[model samples]
Target: MSDILKGLEPERVFRYFEEICAIPHGSGNEKAISDYCVAFAKSHNLWFRQDEANNVIIRKPASEGYEDAPIVMLQGHMDMVCEKNSDVDFDFEKEGLKLRIVDDMIYASGTTLGGDDGIAVAYALAILEDDHLAHPELEVVITTDEEVGMDGARALDVSDLKAKYLLNLDNEEEGQILTSCAGGMKSRAAIPTRHVEWEGVSAVIRISGLKGGHSGAEIHCGRANANRLLGRVLMNLNKELNVGVREVNGGMKDNAIPREAEAKIVLDPEDIQRAMEIKNEFVAAIADEFAVSDPDIRIELNVECNENRQHTIIHPADMERALFVFIQSINGIQTMSMELPGLVESSLNLGIVRTEEDNVNFAWAIRSSKKSLKYLMSDQLQYLAEFVGGTYWYEGEYPHWSFKSDSKLREVVASSYRDLFGKEARIEAIHAGLECGLISEKMPDLDIVAIGPDIHDIHTPGEHLSIPSVERSYRLICDVLSRLKA
Candidate 1:
């Protein structure tokens, strides 16, 4: 707790947010938080249920005079992405998030703050307790494992819910309503590695200091992918000199852009200086290429002899094929939206690459508003993998929510926002994957609109929430509920 957010109007919301921070509720480990919500409902004497998938739904009767209004569902995920700084010692599964207030923002120390969806959960809890606010039938649906997959939302029995309209509290920006989002699928390739004896010096090539971000949300920003850059360096080295790769690894999460990558290779002693020269040239080219997005790119090389080397290096032919395929893989925004100017409609991210004892694995994720485009991208990746003598696989495919131009609830929300703020509000769509896509599949006719307070750097260590924006956003939500009852 800091002085910056001490005097906020939504004291109850902040209080619950703080309480949730103290709990370790990472994406897959959400049982504790789910139980906590259920207990809170029982203590407050509100009707609630814990479904088979651990999704919680709390039902509250309408205010005295608003009983005739249609029911509205306040939706948000209960789980948060488990991400931390590379040097942070805190374990996401055991340790609570350490929150700090800096100026007008609230953030966690060396870890994600979970403000992406936690604020929505807190707001819904506070609203349920506030007897003064005017609203119709309220149903708070808190689902689990939304960060990894929309398992809870997908498993939900829509027939059990009475709400016809849903307000998803998962959007990152305030003053904007997200009407649609892209569908996505994970693509992976496996390349078998064969080791061969090497009689050459060993060196480590490392790439670091790149500004990485969310592959989906920040792809349109034109940030550099470290894995791809590293592959470029390897391809150049193989072309100019004789090198045998012993190990290569980079990046962790599939959803996040890679910041650093390193490779260990055995090469002739005479090629060490030439490799360093090429590394410098590659660094300069990358800096100029990603000047606007990643200006701090760095590449370095270290020469050292192996003292206890027991294994052989990968064959030169195999290394060349793998490096070439990796460098040729297209990453980032591939197509722009025709319907919305400057919006990315289809994109791909080369998320992770690793070398194990006998195989090399490459992981990628593709997101698109159009199903045909997604399949096209997948086919391209599979072709690349097959051309390089590897096998491709797909996982975690989810549907996209197509935009509905004549949504009744969208009209109501737009008019309500204009009346409250005395101006027009932006109704837009995002390229990132959202749980609404899966929820919509279950409830075809349910009207959905996602909104939230201003939050930045979600799914990363620098995540934070804007206090002022949150206060205003909460008030606006209440106004929307009031207008709905009228």
Candidate 2:
């Protein structure tokens, strides 16, 4: 184990956590981590299964006196989001995260700490290997590609799972238990375009320093999407003068709000001066509007070719279609839940935009607590994209992990929490998508709740995990397991 987390409480759990951090386990690249888990099971002499999709299931019979109790499932994904600072030179595909510590928190040097679910994997592995624990039959599941989408959970086979109760260790807060979460999907819209040679002036317009975050978790924060902001700047500029797009590109993932976006455009030489004035006006207006949400927002325009120059740009009609999608696509918190106060009911994010040789493709992440609402938002996008002669498709559709009227597992967990902390744990619903949504769709009878240690800023470079919180949460999970009865 690395010295950064040396001598931490629940030493076994951190040991596994440090071991896995030594391997690159980003989403869609989980084979190494999956195989690592397999090797762990082999060394421990535990029964396990490794699927083609890199999902792992390790089964352990209950302890001597608890064999008659109902089976309990511990679940979390194996993959982490690969996010780093632009200046960080680390290679996610080939390098292990550089672990560091300050005060009670653990962080990876200039990269995401992967604590969102990696700690869950460590917790499950620790329990699985502890033969002295007084627990019911255990089924520990580690899934893959959960950050981009719940692909691993969607493809997971639960027919053989005997667990009637599942404990999902994917929640971020220590004292909060998530009983329900929103359903979501990722979509792509491709607007066909053709290039043409033209003689004109061009400049690259950039929007940066916007505070981007997980689309589902932070959409209600009112931070502006960089892609949408760029679109607005271009749309207003185009109306004043003839403009043709050389290309537009922004954002990295469909599920992350864009932090930076840029576009190259060709326009009349005489319009360049007017465009600068318009750009300044927009900067001041937008800075004031989003001052509270994104305090550091910036816009920069760099002249690449100011003189009449030969250039290849999108056809006028095709450029119009691309711009139409940028402006017309639905985004942000669309509705607030009447049932749950202060919760977003439905929303979407125009998370990514890319202009290529044949098409200008736009990607989105749509989320909603209600299935109908989620579908309604997605359907609107599909039609709008098609309205402009573009093609649309989608993937990673997940169902809502709806709150149950009464849950024995909830009672057990609540009782355990009160016993340990002398206070009630917060039980709430979230706007974000958790793998519980996919698992519940497969095992409707399973009583499930998500719990985790203190992890902050998940899916981002500044992400960190609380070391002390991990020990406490691990004890709570263990206590909960000891109380489970047939």
Cα TM-score per model: 0.93, 0.95
List, residue by residue over 10-75, the lDDT tens digit for candidate 1. Answer: 998888888788888988888888998998899889999998888999999999888999899999
Q: What is the C-alpha lDDT of each candidate?
A: 0.85, 0.89
Q: How close is each model in CA RMSD to the real structure?
A: 2.3, 1.8
lDDT at position 278, candidate 2: 90
Candidate 1 stretches with Cα past 4 Å from truth are 1-7, 304-311
**Please, what's the RMSD in Å of model 1?**
2.3
Model 2: CA > 4 A from native: 267-269, 305-308
Candidate 1: minimum summed lDDT over ten consecutive residues — where?
1-10
Evaluate residue 147 in candidate 2 and report its C-alpha lDDT on the 0 to 100 scale.
Answer: 87
Best by lDDT: 2
